[model samples]
Target: MKFGKIIAAGVLAASLAMPAASFAADKPVVGLVMKSLANEFFKNMLEGAKAHEAKRGDYKLKAVGMQSETDIETQINAVESFITEKVNAIVIAPADSRALVPPLKRAMEAGITVVNFDVALDEKAKKEAGVELAFVGPDNRAGAKMAGEALAKKLGEGGKVVIIEGNPGADNAAQRKLGFEDAIKDGKLKLLDSRTAHWETEEANSVFANMLTAHPDIQGVMAANDSMAVGVVKAIEAAGKTGKIEVIGFDNIPAVQPLLKEKKMLATVDQFGQQMAANAIDKALGVLAVGAPLKGWVKTDIKLVTSDDVK
Candidate 1:
């Protein structure tokens, strides 16, 4: 009788220990790669992902930042490192859509699920690379259209305007420009000059200031992002035309709020960075934890915020 009782207790102990070991094995590891941590936008994305990880203790999140915005080599190396770590999955907002393809393909071949957000790989390239998942950003084209129409309304459809773009090769910039041009196709506005600002505020300021000198009659300015828009506004003010030429920008960063409140900035498109980050992290966790596949694109809506809506 004593021997039988001891055997039963040992069996129960083993059964309890088995489940604990299995649970530890089941915890998913996620890796996030972004353009750079220096930018406030990417920083917010990292914070949101960390918050999600904290809330759901079943997942582990590791975020890696690239050395620079244009450093595709660094990004590729980071992806390779993630692959060697044998993480369950990787979430990347690639610096250059095409440059990261080879490394991403290697990760996929290794049986690690990959998700691309923010920017995307080209369709053919993505197909060839065999990326398992993609979650694209909002409709940049629509957002640009909103800005163009708003500017046309403010300038009454018959004034010269200048456009400051993000980067020449970036899909987001191209899409935004297409939408803005489409909106103004009725000859309502004349685009005097369009140039790349490379998403740098100082560069945008200098470019716009020079353009103002060359085309002082320019009535409005459309910048691809808030950082450039703020720079353009500064240029306009420096040229002593603050109240003359209207300015509209995208990304609706917090710094632009004060400008909008004072009516210095006409309006901006809000991309909802925090919301996008939260959604991406949730999707990543779902795929890692449950083997669910994220297909198609996730569209986060953009809103136009003007002075009246600044509160």
Candidate 2:
């Protein structure tokens, strides 16, 4: 499916069909809280959740998304609202790994089933709050490592590179950064600089353009997500260094296909974001059905994508 083309259509479907409270109150309700509706990854996820609801017709789904990737307050408020609604299950992709823990713990205390997906909540915070939520998502660190290793293979040893990171304190972002650092150590690459773009295209462009200015010798870039990669690629083009620099990113969003085919981007990792929420929802429903609480990580799939794969 061409995800980029379908975002608007999918969002339209989601908006028009948002589960109404007027539906039979006897049915189980699933509240989905996600980050950044502006992101194609989350948009596709929301679309998948909507389709899953339609296919099952057994549960009612109520989804909420943030205004931006780093909108922690909105996510907390969404959780509180869901708790107030007393939804049977709450499937969440947290904005801040730590800050969301308290509210989620409160949800659990209120007897609501909670499942964490996408970005995980901090383990320390969870332990502190006594929240025993199971995580259902991909191994973000491993996925990032796959992309980084691919870049390392292309650049070989001692390659000059910079990293454009996602939002600070986000578990996935931190894991991805560590994975990139792992590749740097294994590949013996010289790291020039690393900075956060908060997962915004424009911010990445500006940050990377400045990084390029400071370090014109940078041979490559590793963006934590495809959204930031779009900006990095743009900055490379604006600086007339498109072909001269190799770039790798995570999240194989549809927008990056042309960049990959054209060799503007080296590679990206696909974590099957569309089905992520549905999978988590299934897990949540299973617990509610059998009265068994889920514990530990329920790992999903991840794959590296390049020009060859796209073609």
Candidate 3:
């Protein structure tokens, strides 16, 4: 009887231990690949994704973030690693639109559901790779245009302005640049020089300072993200242009709040970064369950924030 009891206890212990492993296996593993966690926007995204993983309790999430904003290699390696692990799904906010398509296509071919968010992959690249991943993010162009238009309105027609762009190859960067150009055209603003700071604040500061030096008559500045906007604002302060140059940016991160409130930054676009990854994860899981890929763009909310909104 004692021997029997020992066997039963051993079985119970094994069963208890097995449950965790079994449960984890049964749940879908959704791999999340995000851009630089160093940036406030991506940092918020990571936090929100963690909150979502805890709340959902249905799926296991493996998230990987880049070392820097321009780190496409990390993202590529991350996708390859996720593929080797054979995760059920991959929800990626790709660093480079074209470069990520190939690995993502391989993931799809391996029967993994892939959802692209934050930035849409290039159409030509997708077609070439035969990848039809759905983009689950905001209308970056429209959002950027809204911010640009606010700057345009503030500066009025014939306002000399320079653009401090994001990463060169990033899709969102390209779209935002185009949007800013659209606003410049519509607003009849003078285009001085548009250069990229690769989404770094310090770089933006340096670049804007140089541009300011080149074009001292610059009336307005449009930054692709709020981080860069903060940099531009500092450059303005250092150059003694503080209240003289009107600035606008994207991503309504907390750091930019004071800038907006103080009227240092004319406006910014809130694309709801915190919830973006979660929303994309939801779609990825839905695709996994339904066995149907998400089609086209799954547009999310984007709003323009000005001093009034902050106030």
Ten residues in sequence with the least summed lDDT for candidate 2: 6-15
lDDT of candidates 1 onward, in order: 0.71, 0.82, 0.81
Report the error of model 3 at residue 187, Å.
0.7
Model 2 agreement with the true structure over 89-183: per-residue lDDT tens digits: 78888888899888887777777777777787888987797645566567778888889899899999999999999989789999999999999
| Candidate 3, residue 195: how far the Cα is off, in Å | 0.4
* lDDT for each residue of candidate 3 in 1-311, tens digit (9 for 90 to 100): 11110000000001011123433459988889998888898899889889989988899999999988888999999999998998877888888988988888787777677777777788899779754445556778888888889988988899999999999888899999999999999999999999999898989999999999899999999999998999999999999878999999998999999998998989998877787778777766665554555455545678889889985
Candidate 1 vs 2: which has more lDDT: 2
What are the root-mean-square deviations of the candidates from the true structure over C-alphas? 11.2, 6.2, 10.8
Which has the better lDDT: candidate 2, or candidate 3? 2
Which pairs clash in model 3?
A: none
Q: Candidate 2 clashing pairs?
A: none
Q: Name model 3 segments beyond 4 Å from true.
A: 1-25
Candidate 2 Cα misplacement greater than 4 A, ranges: 1-25
lDDT of 1 by residue, 126-220 (tens): 56755444544678888888988888888876778888987665567777888778667753899899998877778899999989889989998
Question: For candidate 3, what is the TM-score?
Answer: 0.90
Off by over 4 Å in 1: 1-24, 128-133
